[model samples]
Target: MSLENTRHPAGPGLDELVPSRYALRVGDIDVLVVSDGILSLPTKMLAHDADPAVRAAWLKDMFLPPEMVDWALNVVVVRSGDRTILVDAGWGADPNLPRAGRLAQRLEAAGIDLGSVTDVVLTHMHMDHIGGLLVDGIKDRLRPDLRIHVAAAEVEFWASPDFSRTSMPPGFPDALRTAAKRFLNEYRSQLRLFEEKCEVAPGVVATRTGGHTPGHSVVRLASGGDRLTFAGDAVFTVGFEHPDWHNGFEHFPEESARVRVRLLRELAETGELLVATHMPFPSVGHVAVAGDVFRWIPAIWDY
Candidate 1:
């Protein structure tokens, strides 16, 4: 059948009118799961080397649409002691994604004043992760005392000449490079780079987990013996079932898979709260070992 003549089933229509905020207390800290919006990509964009039939069957078995993959754009806000820290800014104001760019609004809904954010911790420099730092290329200087913390390796990778000339899919490298440059230039004065396992806040530390990018890191929040790991993009919901599957957006698929598997195992073993950036809205969960693989056990909803 001709591609145009083929009739593929459709999934549910996009829902953008739902509440995008959730909150929970960890010991003395208040962690808020703030939603920026949803991101939709074609399923073919994942597991590129896997057989198409197998991929379709996997999605079908999961009762998900075989054609598209939907991920939430969730960021975390931690109120520890007298400090308010934001983990990864969402896409600020992108005309292309109307549903997104709601971080500012959601923050307000959660009773958080943008001006009160004292620290911003970045898991990586991926556009979605850092785009919300600026709206229309203008840094949100609402917090005059704002300090932006990022992985030193991440900064170095994006700033390297090699990264600039690296070949990428059409219409990708240019935009990514441009944003990287803009982010660095705008936040130069406030940017604080750190090595592996450096604390970005009182109880928050950046753990080196590069692979998605040259310097992707995961932020861990520990308080009163309770722990939560904000696994930037180390693994998505689907990735729990297939830890070896590599997403197309990863810089180094092999390394990304390796890091993902290791992290999943550790999280599962410890039963720590796992907050994924691309899981369902308010993406807070725990990893459990299911046979030889890992499973995502969503956190109990308090509301």
Candidate 2:
């Protein structure tokens, strides 16, 4: 049902130490999870509103560093009915972020060509989720008529994105603004704006869930009774134990919390597979309700 290779470093001459892709099946659809690499961010961004001591304790308990966290950027590729859908693009370019932005080379290594992607379903326009599309020569390599699906509200919000409630690091707000504006100008013609939900393929659906951003959304894939939801930024690693904790990048922290709790509950009840953007690499897992909070149960790799 799933295939992943994480043995040791690559044989030889490969820049990456290990394979960065995970493959699985949701009924008839083939899904591949690729790592765009990791982002090193401040630990406080994980929960800006939480008590500092408590937050630090939580990180300590998890054996994570108190000052910084390496958040994983997981992107997915889906194949269904002649359609190749890219769920989200990873980081593109940042002089300070050399560790991230490996989506393009990794995709090629996985044998997927840029021109074969029929559609790009953006969870939202946040740089990490859309920046790979901005990389040099990326546009020329992609099919000229490739369709990009995004929530209408998301596109509208970025026209003049308001970061009033967010709590990002010093240079993030301005950087985000620039990337979003550039993406809009370059891809306006390719955008296929949807009001609420859109079907990217036969069994893949993208539904707008306004919280993190006005049009942030999650992709749900269902086929022959198998289900998996790619919850893009709707939930983080700490969210299960403390769904109320507000992540700094959230434009509407309170609303983001509400969305996280709702989505977590729904996943728990359904007992379906869950993959999130910022969870550890190979983020495939299941959700379970534990007393008052939820729990993440990582699925064993099929290998």
Instruction: Evaluate candidate 2 by giving its C-alpha RMSD to the native, one decimal.
Output: 2.3
Q: Which candidate is the best by TM-score?
A: 2
Candidate maximizing lDDT: 2
For residues 115-217, write the lDDT of model 2, one tens digit per residue: 9999999999999999999998999999998999999999999998999999999999998999999999999999999999999899999999999999999
RMSD of candidates 1 onward, in order? 9.0, 2.3
At residue 122, give the lDDT of candidate 1. Answer: 89
Off by over 4 Å in 1: 1-17, 137-140, 161-169
Residue 176's lDDT within candidate 1 is: 74
Error of 1 at 151 (Å): 0.8
Weakest 10 consecutive residues, lDDT, candidate 1? 1-10
